[model samples]
Structure formats: structure tokens, C-alpha cells
Target: MDMLLGVVVMLVKMAVVLGVALGLAAYMILLERKLLGRFQVRYGPNRVGYFGLLQPLADGLKMLLKEDIIPDGVDRRIFLVAPAVVAGTALAAFAVVPFGDGLTLFGHRVPQVVVDSNVGLLLVLALSSLAVYGLALGAWTSDNKYSLLGGIRGAAQMISYELALGLSLVPVVMHARSLSLSDIVAAQAGLPFALLEPVAFVIFIIGSLAETKRVPFDLPEAENELQAGFHTEYSGMRFALFFVGEYVNMVLLGAVTAIFFLGGWHGPFLPPIVWLALKVLAVPVFLIWTRASLPRLRYDQLMALGWKVLIPLALLNILVTGALLAAGV
Candidate 1:
């Protein structure tokens, strides 16, 4: 019965996380459209519902009702699987992200996270890196030159930024002295890492934007140059999954940024969960604002920024952090 209770708790944790994450992601679409519409000085989906509130539900229904189209000459098996790979990795990484402190229900104490793994940070990085497989495989198998180019760009950009993203977090890990995210949060009780490691905070935020393919790093999906980039051949629900994956990734990065730098679930005058929700909500809105404001970078410029600038800066920050630690600073 003990084992069964554990399983039940785990399931409940997963269900809550998924429901919130995916449900928020769905509404995020409506929010982005509304924000972007306002940004561009136009109306959004106000026709759908009151101030477009019901748009996400309508969009979800449309996607579900749409026909699934598989392009000719594509690898049917892998092509079918790629979108799931993208969406699954984006969602699965949230398992280790703690939303708030523990809560007691029915005489049981439940942790806020779905699974508080010791190697959570590493797992998130690994899962993020694995998302490239979906992009690459989907593009390569599409038998479309435009899709192929988009895939290549997407794969290269993500891999390039991954290095900097990892290095930027190294100082946080060193200061926190644990790879567990919960421990990282606890270590920040006195002060947030963002105030202490400003450089790493900037690098991590910038690297995260690149990691999620948001502008001005959205060269991978440059519509003007290579159609819709890697997902050109995808239609209906398959295409929708890729769209969903991007928003979820934005939320994932926001949560991570909060945990790593902004002090996860820590604030005054509100609940811990509310603090977390505010941070998570802020990130994608920022990303959307950026999308409206910034132009896509050239491929060469993108590569140079990641390789020549961010990575080296991240390394320098890590070195400085190491020296400070050695000096007890």
C-alpha cells in the first residue's frame, strides 16, 4: 500500500503539472496574439470570445478537428514521431521544476515537484539537447529543401547555445553547491543569484532565448527565407504540436530562470506559488515583445554571437566565479 500510495501521488503531481503547463500554453497562444496585435497596432482575436478569452479553446478544437497531412516521399515512421519528440521533451523537463513548497493533503506531505531528482539540472539540459533530434529528423525526412535548410539552421543554433547555457549555470551550481533545483532555491533564501551573478544571469537569459528559437535568434524558422523553416511540410495536429512545444519551452525556460537566478517561489506579500506563476508568465510575454520588436539575425551573426561572444563570456564568468569562491568573496 505504501508503494501504491507513492505511485498515486506521483500521478497526481504529473496530472497537475501537465494540466497547468499545457493549459497555460494553450492560453499563451491567445495572449501572444492579443499582445502582438496590440504591439502591431491592430485587433486580435476579439471576435472569438470576450476579449478573445475563449480563443485558445477554439484553437484547440480547430487543431483537433483538422486533417493530419503526411507529405509525399517523407519517412512515414520518423516523420510521425518527430512532433511528439518535440512536445514530449518540452513537457517532460518540467517534472523536476518545483512550483512551490510542499503541501499536506489527506495526512500526506507532497512535494511541489513531480520528481525532485538529484540531477535535475542535467536532465533538463539533456532533454533540451534531445529536442534537436525532432527538428533534424523532421526536416531531413521532409524531402523539401527549405525544410532541410531550416532543420540545419535550427540544429546548429540550438547546439551552439547549449554550451553557453550550461556554462552560465555553472556559477549558480558552484554557489548553490548542488545540482538539485530545490537545493538551488534554498540556497537563495538570503538573496537571488541574479543580483550576485549578473553576467551569468544575462548570459543565461540570452542563451535561453536562443535555445527556444525566439527572435532575434529565430533564424531556424525564418519564414521569409525558408518558408516555415523545419515545419514547412507539417500540417494539422503534427504542426500544432511543434507550435505547442515552442510555447511550453518558453514556460520551461521561465521557470528555470526563476529557479536559477530570480529565486524560485521566493517573495513577500504573496504565496510562493503566486510568485512562481508571475515569473513564469513574465518570460513568454517578454519573448513575445521581443518578437514584435527585433528582427531575425543572420545565420552567420547568430553563430558568431553564440560561439565567439556568449560562450567565451560564459567561460570568463565561470572563471571569475571560481576565483571569488577560492578567495571566499
Candidate 2:
């Protein structure tokens, strides 16, 4: 009965998280378009509903109703499965993220996370790495040279940045002495990791932007160059899946950043959950601002920044952190 109850609670948590995540991913698109319009001094998406509040709904409906075109002479099975892989991996990374402190309900204590594994960071990194497979396979199967080029660029960029991204967190883990994200958050009670390890924070932010394929690092989807990038051939709901996955990845990376650097669920004069939510929301806004302000980097520049600059800096940061820890700082 205890095990069964635990299973039920986990299921409930998963459902709630999935619903909120998907909803946020949809609405974030609306928010980005609206804000981008304001940034560029134009009105954006005010047609479907009042202030375009229903734009996401309308867009979703259109995707559902539109024809899903699997292009001729393509590998059908992998093409169909690729988007799901991307979306699923992105969503799954959230399972171990702690949104708040534990709660007491019906004389039982429940963790805020769906899965509280000790290696939660590893799980997230692994899932992120797996997302590349979908991109690569999708592009290869599409049989389009443009898509193939985009996929190659994406895979290379992500792989390069992943080194910096993973290494950037090592300082935090070293300070916290645990791979568990919750422990890392708790370690920041006195001072958030961002204050202690600003270099890591910067590297993580840059790497994260690359991971999400946002502006300045979005060579993979360079519309001027690759038409539509890896998902160029996809249409309808399949296209929507890739689109939604990007936003969801943004949200996930934001939460991870909040947890690891900004002190997750640790703020004064606000409930822990609310604090977490606000921090999570702030990241996407920053990302949008960046997209508005910065132009995309050339593919060579993108790769050079990740491999030559970010990765080296991340390694240096790790060494400095190790030295500090050895000195008992």
C-alpha cells in the first residue's frame, strides 16, 4: 500500500508538471512574439483574441488541423519518430527538478520533485545529450541537403557547448559536494553559486543559449542560409512538436539555472514555490531580450566561441575552484 501510494503520488506530480510545462511552452511563444514586437516598435499578434491571448490556442488548432507532409523519398519511420524524441527528452529533464521545499499533506511528507535521485544532474545532462540524436536522425532521414547541413551544424554546436555546459556546473558540484540538485540549492543558502562562481554562471548561460539554439548561436536554423534548418521538411503537428520542444528546452534550462546558480526556491518575503516560479520565468525573459538585442553569429564564429573560448574558460574555472576548495575557501 505504501509503494502503491508513492506510485500514485509520482504519477500525479508527473501529470501536473507535464500540463504546466506544455502550457508554459505554448504561452511563452505568445509572450516572445508580443515582446519582440514591442522591442521592434510594432504590434504583434493582436488578431485572434483580445490582446492575442488566444493566439497560442489558435496556432495549436491550426497545427492540429493542418496536413502533416512526409516528403517523398524520405525515411518515414525515423522522420515520424524524431520530433517525439526531441519533445520527450526535453520534458523528461524536468522530472528531477525541485520546484519547492517538501510539503506535508495528510500526515505524509512529499518531495516537490517527481524524482529525487542523487544523480539528478547527470540525468539532465544525459537527456540533453540524447536530444541531439533526434536532430541528427531527423535531418538525415529528411534527405534534404539543407536539413542535413543544419543537423550537422546543430550537432557539432551542441556537442561543443555541452562540454562547457557540463564543466561549468562542476564548480557548483565541487562546492556543494554532491551531484544532487537539491543539495546544490541548499548549499547556496548563504550565497548563491552565481556570486561565488561568476565565470561558471556566465559560461553556463552562454552554453545554455547555444543548447537552445537561440539567437547569436542559432546557425543551425539560419533561415537565410539553411531555409528552415533541421526541421525544414516538417509541417503541421510534427513541426509544432519541434517548435514546442525548443520552448520547453528553454524553460527546463531556465529552471536548472535557477536551481544551480540563483538559489532555487530561496528568497525572502515570498513562498518557496513562488520564488522558484519567478526565477524560472525571469530566465526566458532574459533569453527573449537577448534574442532581440543580438544578431545571430556566423557558423564559424559560433563554433569558435563555444570550443575556443567557453570551453577553455570553463576548464580554467574548474581548476581555480579546485584550488580554492583545497585552500579551504
Candidate 3:
């Protein structure tokens, strides 16, 4: 009975998480369309569902009904698996994110997370980094020059930004003096790290946008230049997988940022889950705002900023944080 109960509970939680993530990713597409429309002084996605509420559903149906096209002479296996791998990695990264207070289920104290290792933060980082493999595979397997170029550019860009992204967390790890994400949150019980490590927070957010290949850093899929970039030849549900993965990744990054800098599940007046929702929503808005305000940097310029500006600043922030901690100041 206990074993059956555990299985049932796990399945339920998995269903809930995936359902919420899929729904959120779908709406995120609409949110971007609507918000970016306002920014550009236009109405967006108003043709489907009331106020475009059904736009995502329409889009999903379109993607599902569209023929799945596999490029001629392409590596069939890898091409088919690439998007799935990316989406899986993106979803898996959420395992350690505490959604809300622990819930009592079947007389067991079950936390919202699927797994809560001592190195939860490190695990999340590692999983996020691995998501790049999907992009690389999708591009390489397509056997097109443009796809190859986009894949190479995407891989190179992610590598450059990931270093800064990882380094920016050094200060948080240093201050919290621990790696477990829950401990990090506990350290910020009174005040958030964004207040202390402002520079690191800034670097992390910038690096995150780059990591996710958002606008102003979306050189990989610069449609005007790369013909839709890495997944250029992909169509139908395969292409939809890539699209879903992108928004899911955006949500994952936002969740990580919330836990690290903004204080995970920490707030007053509203419940913890509500606070998390508000924080996660802020990320895409910021991304869209950046897209509306800034121009994409040259590829070389983007790499240079990651290596020269963000990295050094991240390191310096760590140094200062360490010194202050040492001096008890």
C-alpha cells in the first residue's frame, strides 16, 4: 500500500508540474506577442480565443497537425531526439526548486520538489548547461550550412556566457557559505542577495539572457541572417519542441534567479508560491523590455563582453564579498 501510494503521488506531481510548465510556456508565447505588440504599438494574436487566450492552443494545434519534416540525408535519430533532450533538461532543472511549503500527502511529508539533494544548486546549474547539447545536436544533424552556422554560433555564445553566469553565483555561494539552495534561501531570510551583491546579480541576469539566447543576444536564431537558425529545416512538432523548450528554459532561468538573488519562496503577505510566480513573471518582461530597448550586439562584441566585462566584474564582486566577510564588515 505504501509503495502504491508513493507511485501514485509521484505520478500526480509529475503530471501537475509538466502540465503547469506546458501551460505556462504556451501563455508565455502569447505574453511575449501581446507585450511586444504594445511596445511596437500594435495588437498581437487577437485572432484566436478571446483576447488571444486560445492563441497558444491554436498554435499548438497548428504545430501538431503540420507535417513532421526530416531533412534529406540528415541524421534521423539525433535530429529526432535533440529537441526532446533540450526540453527534458529544461524541465529537470526545476526539480530542486521549492515551490511552496511542504505538503502532507498520504501521511508523508512530501516537499514540492522531486529531488532535494545537498548540492541542489550545483545540480540545477549542471542540468541547465547540458541543455546546450540539444541545440548543438539539432543544428549539426540538420546537415545545412545555415543550421550548422547557427548551431556553432549558439554553442559558442552559450559557452561564453555560461562562465560568467557560473562565476556570478560564486558570491551567493560565498555569502551563504553553502551550496544547498535551501540554505542559500535561509541565508537571505532577512535580506536578499540582490541588495548585497548587486553587481553579481546584474551580471547573472545579463548572462542568463545570453544563456537563454533572448533578443539582443539571439544571434543564433537571427532569422534575417540565419534563415531561422539551428532548427531551420525542422518543422511540425519537432520545431514546436524547440519552441516549447525555449520558453521553458526562460522560466527555469527565472526560477533560478528568484531562488538565488530574490529570495526563493520568501515573502510577506502573500504565500511563497505567489511570490515565486511574481518573480518568474518579471523575468520575461525584463527580457521583452530589453528586446524593445536595445539592439543585438555584434557576435564578436557579445563574446567580448562575456569574457572581458562580465567575467572580470563577477570575479571582482566575489573578491569584495570574501574580503568583507573576512573582515566581519
Candidate 1, superposed: residue stretches over 4 Å from native: none
For model 3 the local lDDT of residue 8 reads: 84
Candidate ordering by lDDT (highest first): 2, 1, 3
Question: Which stretches in model 2 have alpha-carbon errors above 4 Å?
Answer: none
Clashing residue pairs in candidate 3 (N, C-alpha, C atoms within 3 angstroms): none
Off-target runs (Cα >4 Å) in candidate 3 are 1-3
Query: TM-score: which is higher, 1 or 3?
Result: 1
Pairs with backbone N, CA or C atoms under 3 Å apart (clashes), candidate 2: none
lDDT of 3 by residue, 1-329 (tens): 98888778778787788788878888999999998999999998998878989999889999999999887989899999999988889998877776765798757898777666779889988998898999999999999999999999999999989899999999899889888887888888899999988999999999999988998899999898999999899999989999888999888877888889998779999988898899988987898789888998888899899999999998888889899989998
Candidate 3 whole-model C-alpha lDDT, 0 to 1 = 0.88
- What are the lDDT figures for the candidates, one per model? 0.92, 0.93, 0.88
Give per-residue CA lDDT, model 2, range 1-329, as digits (tens).
88888989999999999999999999999999999999999998999999999999999999999999999999899999999999999999999999877888668999999999999999999999899999899999999999999999999999999999999999999999999988999998889999999999999999999999999888888999999999999999999999888999989988999999999999899888889999999999999999999988888888889888998899999999999899988
What are the per-model C-alpha RMSD values against the true structure? 1.0, 0.8, 1.4
